[model samples]
Target: MPEAHIARTGPRILVFSTNPISDPGIDLVGSAHMRYQPGVVTIPVPCSSGIRPSWLLHAIEAGFDGVFIAADGGDCAFVPDCTTRTAKIVDTAQKLLTEHGHDPQRIKMAAICSVCAEPFVNHMEKFSAALEALEV
Candidate 1:
């Protein structure tokens, strides 16, 4: 088979999606033919609250222009307080970015539901625009 080609002409975003919640929504964005930036990528985790702050920093250090946490919010099956925990994670990650001389705005978080394809695509577009504006 011919090698697949992906155009990387935009801000790169690394997304952490909760497996039981946001992941399905992100997947639906593709399966439903919703359009988003080509540089957007995703990794599914068991819970958004479980994401390590270091991972967010690593994504930036590894060349991703921004990191987006697709939080499970109140829909998390694994943790009742997942939204609160994830918010703390985002806060810590933003502080870490700031301490490293990176803009705290490079990271964003939002709740995405199981069938929220349009919202996911919208978030990606807006996040990509915001990252481009940062121009770092």
Candidate 2:
């Protein structure tokens, strides 16, 4: 792929997060001086459920090694079934990735509340490691 041929200093990650829930959690990570891969990039969305499966595919093709969706879960004020809807989105994206000859595990989804800074950091660490292992 064109993106693959581009040189990168480290694995790139794209994080899609909900504004009310996951965004705060991500901010907390910085406020608390938490350590995670600096290459992890975040984009705040109104809700994770609204993300199109093609967007995830585009990210991978654009050179992102992994994609992470930080869902609002039970804290979602927009939808009662936010988590379920988000999961379905991930599942669809995973299927598409597999059909395109990519590993589905590169995409992941998790409920991240306002206080989930630690969890977010941990997830980033694990995901970065997973991508590194894929290079082996």
Each model's total of backbone clashes: 0, 0
lDDT of 1 by residue, 29-135 (tens): 88998788778889999999999999999999999999999999889888899899999999999999999989999999999998988999989989988888899
Per-model TM-score versus the true fold: 0.93, 0.91
Clash pairs (backbone) in predicted model 1: none
Candidate 1 lDDT for residue 57 = 95
Question: What is the C-alpha lDDT profile of model 2 across 49-117, one tens digit per residue?
Answer: 899999999999888999999999999999999999999999999999999988998899999999899
Q: Which ten residues in a row have the lowest lDDT in candidate 2?
A: 1-10
Give me the overall lDDT of model 2.
Answer: 0.91
Q: lDDT of each structure?
A: 0.92, 0.91
Candidate 1 lDDT trough over 10 residues, lowest sum = 1-10
